[model samples]
Target chain A: MKRVLMRGNEAIAEAAIRSGLKCYFCYPITPQGELVEYMARELPKRGGVFLQAESEVAAINMVYGAAAAGVRTMTSSSSPGISLKQEGISYIAMARLPCVIVNMMRGGPGLGNIAPAQGDYFQATKGGGHGDYRLIVLAPSSVPEAAELVGLAFDLSDRYRVPAMILADGMIGQMMEPVALPEPVDPAEIPPRPWAVTGAKGRPKNVISSFDLEPEGLRRMNLVLQETYREIERNEVRWEEVETEDAELLLVAYGTMGRIAKTVVRLAREEGLPVGLLRPITLWPFPYGPIRALAERVKAVLTVELSAGQMWEDVRLAVEGRTETPFYGELGGVVPSPGRILEEVRRYVR
Target chain B: MSVELAIPRGYTRVFSRPAALSEAGFTYCPGCHHGIITRLVAEAIDELGILERTVGIAPVGCAVFLDRFFNCDFVQAAHGRACAVATGIKRARPDLVVFTYQGDGDLAAIGTAETVHAANRGENITVIFVNNGIYGMTGGEMAPTTLPGQRTVTTPRGREPRSHGYPLKISEMLAQLDGPAYITRQAVFDYPHIVKAKRAILKAFRNQLEGKGFSLVEILSTCPTNWRMSPVEAGRWVAEEVSRFYPLGDLKDTG
Candidate 1:
């Protein structure tokens, strides 16, 4: 009912609970520890299952287990921790289990640092694990958006029977924001999971397996997964277009980078420069169509990210020579300021 | 060819295939022991009358096909992650009886983190660990439980302590942990050992049924084809050399 002033990580946890999360299995990692702490305290009180798993690998498998049993499950981790979870994530993807994963990204090629960075764009959007699969990646630009996306993640995961990841950076994970929490969903209102491995009671047994040893069987399963993904690409693309109606210069970003780029757009416009921002809310089923159409009008597009221009490739594909596409980004845990981003925009335009 | 067996009219069958075990054709190599273990698990599930509330977690290796034989619900876990998956299911639906069937490589090597932690947390679940001392699914390779001097495809020159490291006794190691209610290592090579193994399995299942904490039955099985032995030789090897290295009987029974 009332808006609660909470940290981004805390809000994400609370929002997930309201979305009827019945089980949570997570290991503590930097920039996302508060979310685990919140669940540890609240889930038990609410008569739900909460377990601090031994490692990120264990946590994801636990999510796999709970989801197989027809329960709403979630897990959270940061960059390196997320890497440890790739094996389990691939299984979850292959099994087509519906679970929510929150990746509050920190810097990394390894255990890089514990500061905010959008370094996981490629890892999140592109299949991070070894498989022919893709996670439903949602990039939330602000703390409120991050909270909202957490709920959307569970909904989408169930709707598509896929793992949906909320891609937030450390800034969004740690910063405090006033968010109006949604009303809790009644678990009874949720539809039954007929495929879950509850038991072979009065019906046929359900087996949640990824092993299809036959060549034809594996091919058939992959085809089914690819079709679902194609449908997601068609209907689930989301984005925010800010002042792009008639702008000659465009800034493309997502997650916290999108928020910083917006400020850059305002600063450039104040100096009579033609600039606007296009913040993609969904990064995997990336908004390629909108970017291609917008590229027709803009003179040039500048892609901004917290990594060394990982999302730049996607922007380039979307532009497809319609406009001159260039990129600028900070490395490791560095967050580019509005001034620095504006300077990059001036360099691109001039 | 003509001796008629005496007919006992009052004789009723004491055992048939358990109701929870389906009549699926087992694909295990002749005398692989996976069939026996699966049968024992099915018998335990039926004896406890938890078939309607039981969920089995299958491992990544040979037992990955456990779903085909178990009439109850089953979930196939990633390589070496059966224990963790079972923990999740048991925790979420506390009323269900969840168990994992894992092999040497899956339980002791790649999935050590999951296995150790799930047991350390005292998760209310059962784990049936099949230790044949080699990785059978990937074509005979050195496993973490492979005995010293044991040769396989990976260790063609025999397992050298310096190069291959030492075999890990995970059952003994896990038994020392404070969290587990029952932890034992038994064999199914002979009828007497098979009987003891079944009793241990039934007890572990009963422990989980009574809400007792972590329980695991590490069955010292034989991989006949992988060992390059006749099925008969494999059983003899399991009794002599394997039994000498990994002693039989319960290592821990806190219950």
Candidate 2:
């Protein structure tokens, strides 16, 4: 019930620990380095295992191992490190292991910079690695939401036996905000992982693997995964709408850009532009239905991001030519101002 | 009295499959040493009475189906990340015995970094490394432990150090690390070498049971089908040729 000011990265770490994280493994990278440092200092105190892995690849594999061992596990990294973790992530997804992965975003195609960017939207929502798979992606626009969403990420991952991701950026990770942290979960009350490989004490030996060499066998396994994804899509679509009741134009964004668009909406409304904002919280089970329905009434929908219009394609898919869809993005970690976003809105509104 | 009358009914069973190994038949090629090595490891588990508390990590090579062959709980790792995976399992459940069964390509080439770092961190786990000098599952491709002048599918005209680089001495390299409690390279070509290799596998597993950190037993194995030789001729090659480059014996023992 007590609100305490904490940095966004550290708040996420605290939330994970409270959510009964058994093991934390990661390699250091920019913007998210504080999260690792926080875990290194706090996780051991809570009787949890903390390891600074050799590389991002090793870190994700460690998560896979711990998750298979029937424990809540996690790994954090920035842009470059997340790319290195793709192989393990793919294996984890196919293996149907439950784990949390946090990517505090940074600019990149290569090693762009340590600054904030939303360049990984495509990678996070789409298949970043090989094979047919999807991650339950959550994007938090503020430190408080970031902390709260960490718990939801763990829960949804465990509920569906799927990997979940917290996609945030440097601005949220570096900034400080007041947050009332979630209560620490009782480890005994955590959901039982009947399928985990726990030494087969009194039961049949459990074997955790994602490989099925036979054509028919592999097809069956993939179909099961697709069914689970459909279930998630049916139930887990989440978003936030503001000032949308009678607005003529809609603004779509997420994470850092989404929070900025909130201000842009207010600024545009004050100038009688009649703008509303739709912020997607779940990036993969994206708010397509909401966007599509809003597009039916709005004159135009504009997407703003920190990248060169990566999430814009998804907006267009949701709109489906119901209305005009325009994209405005700033590349290379540029944080566009509210006034700048309002100017883009003015172009679309009239 | 007859010899059979002096012993109990069950006492006559001297050479049966270890209880730790399942009834599932191994999928390895004929004359491959994986069968022997897996049996040896299972034998160690049975002898140590830890089958109920042991977790095996299957690598992403020919032994990728290692989970099917073991009665104990098993988790399959991504290519070359067995050591890291084993480390995670062991650290998460320290009460459970964890070990990785990895081939040369899965341990020394693509996974070299994970292998080295796991050893360096002194993660309390056993590593059963099988070095056959070529990528057997991937059709006799050149491996990190492939010997110079050895001809694999990738090296059609024999491995040239100028182009392919030198064979990696993983045991020798890992032995230098202070974290390892045991590091040994043994072969399984014939009776004597097979006996020694079995002993090495037991020793490595025992180290994990005793809470010793990072023990690796590199067993020089055979790949007859990939080597384009008969089973008998491949065993001879392991004895006469492969043993020369990867000489058998203990490189380090912190015990």
Candidate 3:
């Protein structure tokens, strides 16, 4: 293990390289452009492929091609760019290919702002692309978690034969923190993809696509995808429960908000307020079981986020009539500080 | 002893159930140019033995369900987004032949930014652009390729140059870039012109196979139903009037 100081975006890019990814295709967009630039420089140095695609649409399609070829490939972009990539993402999911995507989310609804925003909660966790498809969305609260999640994303994507996403925001991507890098995985040790389109040798042929128009065929495809999702939900719901042993107020947050909420929890504890934090690591296949348990004991559940009220809906669903959930958020690129959250906690607890 | 050669019975028999053609039985009217263009692209893929390795991206217009017509991997992109989707596929799998089938509206209007940038980047992919001057899928609206003085749904009384913009020259504009390996403008209104269009498409596909950069073939096609003209009149207009504004010839063939 090598400990080094790195930005969240750079750490994720380093993790992608260490995971034996051979292709990086992306177009420059704010908050995530640094990640693409890092790949453009590092991929070529390591004998991998790097391309600054024509647009977000092109970048995503390039990811589809690379993923179809069965090489570890990825793309990175901000919120607006991710919107441009929706069609390609749907096709990639439909094809059931293993690829990584990093969305360093920013404010949006149409070029809302460039700063970080958790507004993409519904888009990321609840299927941003069309049709009945879900990307395994990993929300990293810190730079180290961002790097760690990249490796996990690769593993999960390959194991499930589906696309996985590392959904961060501007804060995580822009913040600097210490990260201990894992030993690089050997490219040769990774299982070979027999179905990859690597020049089509004596084999019959390999086709990767998302078009099954026959009603029965499309229905069957959707069923298979749903089954895979169900399995994921059963096996991959991850979260961190901090100090829930004797707390009355439970805070639910993820990504950047989760990081801030941690600080708020510490401050509340110092001030003698009984507060606990539930930070979801996997946004999709969300860690609802633990949250539901916490909701039962807590007096009130406070959902903190950067968006107006995106993840609050998820929190409500998880608690579901068991508890009253009040949301606190800052809209349009305004991220709440720990001080502000602490005040809200004091009001809710009292 | 005598040697004998077996020939295929018909053109339809030559194709292997196009995976790109939708099951919806084509919403296009009789004598629509989309069917011809679809057949031409499918035939080229068949002849080149690239069906398994080909990925076709359908645009948002009438041919959005191109996945139904071609028996290869297919992706349906947003309006004017075929090029972007094709770029992703090609970049991910360099060995696979990726192409986009887009209409005038999808290519020229909403997707112009994507198209221009993809061409500029020289992504190793092919683009099959069907330019019918009018937005055929939508109700005969004026398109960027709409010729001067042409009557369209948006331009009811003969398009005025002072009000409506002049016809766009997509092939010539693309040819200006050194990155584009091939750029051609062909028509499919007649048999001879159809043959030329096929050749251009085959060349574009071959370029991608050879790792040559971006290649686009702008097919000046007819839209009799949308243009409110007889099939014969539409074909004649493409040859006599449309071709005068958007010339039917190869503008640049670097390969």
lDDT: which is higher, 1 or 3? 1
Evaluate all candidate structures by whole-model CA lDDT and list the values in order: 0.90, 0.92, 0.83
**Model 3 C-alpha lDDT per residue in residues A1-350, reported as the tens digit of each score:** 66899988899999999998888888888988678778888888987888887677877777776776678989999898988888878888888888999999998779888898888888888888888899999999999999999999998998888799999998999888989986788988666787665543455445565665489988888888999999999998889988888989999999999989999999999999999999999998888788898898999999999887788888888899898799899888888789999989988885
Name the top TM-score candidate.
2
Clashes of each: 0, 0, 22
True contacts kept of each: 0.88, 0.84, 0.30
Docking class of 2: high
Clashing pairs in 1: none
- Who is ahead in lDDT, 1 or 2? 2
TM-score head-to-head 2 vs 3, winner: 2
lDDT per residue for candidate 1 within B1-255, as digits (tens), equals 233456589886665678888778787999899889899999888888989999999888888788998899999898988888998899889999999999989999999989998888889999999999999989999999999999999999899989889999998999889999999999999899889999999999989988888999999998999999999999999999998999988888885
User: What does candidate 1's lDDT look like per residue over A206-274, in tens digits?
Assistant: 999888989999999899889999999999999999999878888999988899888988889898888
TM-score of chain B of 1: 0.95
Model 2: per-residue Cα lDDT at residue A161: 91
Q: Which stretches of candidate 1 lie over 4 Å from their true place?
A: B1-15
Compare candidates 2 and 3 on DockQ and give the better one.
2
- Residue pairs in candidate 2 whose N, alpha carbon or C atoms collide under 3 angstroms: none
Q: What does candidate 2 score on TM?
A: 0.97
Off by over 4 Å in 3: A90-98, A107-116, A129-133, A188-221, A332-339, A348-350, B1-29, B34-36, B42-53, B62-76, B158-164
